[model samples]
Target: MSTAQLVSLTLAMLAGAVTLLGLVIVTGRALHRRRTRRDARLAADFRPLLLELTGGDDDIDEPLRRLAALDRRRWRAVEPSAISLLTKVSGHAHAALVSLFAQRGLARAALRDLDRFGAVRRATAAHVLGLMGHTEAAPALAGLLSDRSPEVRAVAARALGQIGAAEAADPLLASLAAGGGVPFHLVAQSLIRLGPGARPALAKALYHPEAAVRAVAAEVLGLTGAVETARVLIGVLAGDPSGEVRVRTARSLGRLGTPVCLEALIHATGPAHPHAVRVEAATALGDLGSPRAVPALCDLLGDPQYHVAHNAARSLARLGSGPAMAVLAETVAERPGTTAAGHAWEALAVLDLQAGQLRRPPTAPVS
Candidate 1:
């Protein structure tokens, strides 16, 4: 064919493709709208019954029976709302919902969906299992932590936490290494949800090769109130090579607040440690709330590192002991031009403001 003829044919085919694409888009939107309307109708019909059952105010037996007997389409329509409430309701309402889900075989179905090829299906299943608090599905959910999809991994991590799967703690910590796309905050939250039962695992994670994992494990240990792991955290605070990890460890030790951690936290505040580590350590000393920390914290007030000295003064105030306050007062009076004095003045001013607020009379309500 001649060049002009070939070009004209190409344009004709492009026009036809564009027209076909527009038709497909219109058809897809039409179908989605229809589906949405159907879902809305179903939700309106059934969601009230669910609310009544979960509300714990009325007779739940009737609502529970109706929900349990729902046909597949109706159940599908209401499933999202039910799952959404799983995390919100508690006491009898929460228990009733779990029983309803089990009677409907949702737990088993969600377990199967965990292995589905679609990422959304896998994530949704993980979410359902987690919300249902299905302990039996914990292992399957744990497997999804390493799934190819980042979202699936995140959902799986969350589910494992909700399920209280202590076994999954190690894997959750490991996911923080190089290629694990899961957010560190999510992992930490899950570990915390796992509670003290995961402390043994979290304590074990303190020695993990990855610094990120170690840091998270240390922080979660403190948040979970794993006072038993104070020694472990103290060691981490003193010897961990990563400054970030050491900082977290010091903070955790402070939260643990065992007197055993005092030497380690004080040592961490020394100039030998990183500035960040020293700052966290100084703050942690206040959290420790030990009068013994008074001397070390007073010394920290003199450190050239502004943040370290600043935190030290605050920690001294937090100690709330006469000696600690005396140090702050003396620093303010004797070291007027110094960094220590500035921090001391701020702490004393805050104390005075708090005292004034306490002494103020309560305002009567307007009629």
Candidate 2:
């Protein structure tokens, strides 16, 4: 080959290589510049929506929809790199959108946005989906309950609880594994929010390895009056590691008023027990108006705590059987000036059907 021909070929190859390198550098710079501009735009876009809603606009959901579409379609094309940033920005938009939908009573519209942008997997997006009560997103958000980030998992668990849909229980249940901290409280409250949806999960949670979780589960189930969960409450009355938890469980079981739980309540009233819990359980039995519990309550009439004796007297009056009446009359006669005596007078006022009234006639039940 000729020297000039070879030299021309060499220079042409090196030039092509340099040209390629220069193009890549320019592309990198373009991406950087575009990203910076897009972030600013996202913040700007979020501001108007936030201010408009907070400024008391009656409705801005329609406009928010248009704004979201601009990201999902246009900006995502010119800057395909912007999808993630845009999706996260869309979550803040949805938080505002929820209020508009509620004000307009547009359930369908709210669900649509949740089902769409909620897939972004950002904490803000999870929260928006939750506030919207999107049941369909349970499986997706449920996966976030153990997210490496506590904030993300907390939002997901909290949202599931608010959703209160049966589908969300499993994920909320999984959140119980979160050791002692804000996550535990967040998860427990969400399950409690479910009410009926939370019963089975709470019943299972009673057996959690963490005593704190188990204890909170019992109290929550009791507050929920999940009669179906009575067995768990009764079981926790004994062998539970925490005194506060057991005390609460006893009171809850007492409220259940089932004969099956009476034994547990009586057992919990031992001298070692919290006075408040023992008194509540005894009062609950008395309220149940069971003749069978008269002996135990009569025994408590002499309890060291004035409150205990008072509750015992009140329960005896409610039972209305001859033995309860006799036992109450004896206590009042024996200790007329003590606090128990004061409570005895109050008990008569409550039942209003006194020993004299019971003696006079076989009246029909009060219903």
Candidate 3:
């Protein structure tokens, strides 16, 4: 063929391919819309029956049987909304939903999906199983924590948490120990969802061989505000070799707010402690709102770490005594244009606001 004819032919083929791609995209979008509408209609039809089932007054065996008769597509639409209500309701209502899931074999179906090669499929399966809150699915979900997919592992941890079975605690902790891609924060959240039942395991974790595990355990215990673990946490703060663990322990100790916790925090703020530990300790003392912390917090204002000085100033504002106020004023005057000065000025304002003195403090130029 001539050169001009060859060029023209190539251009025609490119145009055809672009047209085909556009057609496929449009067709896919149209199908998605149709599926969404169908799902919405099915959800509306099931809403009333699901609400009635949640009331738990009537015999639900018949309703559950009827629900189980739904085709897979319709059941998929209804299950998400059902689980949404299940999460909000407890007692008989929650039990009714679990019974419904069992009658429909949803948990079994989810378990089968856990073995699927697809990541999204495995994650969704883990979510559904978790929502069912059935103990039978816990082992399968626990196994997924070792899956190659990070997304799948995270979802499985969440599912284990939602199940709230104490048996899942050790498995979850093991996953943390194995050091897969699963984030410590997600694992910590899962443990928190297990409630007080997980406290003993978490306390044991405070002494885990991995410093990360011990640090996370301290953080989770503090969030739980379980006073029973305060002594253990104080010990960790005082002696744990890991500076990160000591920092987390200091924060948790502040959340605990016991007399012993206060004492431990005061010791942590000492110059001998690591800078990170001292910073968190000073911050926690402010959170405790104890007048006894005033002296220690004041001493922290001259800490070499700017963060420690800033936090100490803020805590003094929280304490709101004449001595604390005097320290803030001095820091603001002596360290003008520095971060410490800014913190001191802000602390004075916070004190004024709390005292119903809303007038703006005299401005100093910040460098």
Whole-model lDDT, model 3: 0.86
TM-score of 2: 0.54
Write model 1 residue lDDT over 1-367, tens digit each, in one string: 9999999999999999999999999999999999889998998899889889888775788999999999999888898889888889888899999999999998898888988899999999899888888999887876787899999999989888888878878788878977587889999999999877788888888888889989999999888888888887888877889999998888888898899999988888888888999999999999999999999998888889899998999999988959999999898777766778788888877777877843222233355
Badly placed stretches (over 4 Å) of model 2 are 1-124, 139-157, 170-180, 183-189, 195-197, 272-280, 286-289, 313-330, 346-367
Between candidates 1 and 3, name the one with more favorable lDDT: 1
Where model 3 places Cα greater than 4 Å from the true spot, the runs are 1-36, 55-65, 71-77, 320-345, 354-356, 359-367
The order by descending lDDT is: 1, 3, 2
In the predicted model 1, the residue pairs found to clash are none
Q: What are the per-residue Cα lDDT tens digits for candidate 3 across 1-367?
A: 9999999999999999999999999999999999999999999998888888888676876667777788998898998888788779988889899888887887888889999999999998898888778778888898999999999999999999989988777778777774666799888899899899988889998989988788888998999988999999999999999999999999888888888788889989888998888889999998777778877876777677888988998889877757777878887887776666677888888767887888465567655
**Tens-digit lDDT track for model 2 on 1-367?**
9999999999999999999999999999999899778766765655554455434455766655554445433433322222233324435444565544454333444344433433344666566567666677677677777666677777778888767787566556655655622366777688778878667767877877766667667777766777877776877877777776776677677666677887777777668777767777777777556688888887877787887888888888878759888776666667656666556666765565543453222223344
Clashing pairs in 2: none
Q: What local lDDT score does residue 156 receive in model 2, on the 0 to 100 scale? A: 76
Candidate 3 residue pairs in clash (backbone atoms < 3 Å): none
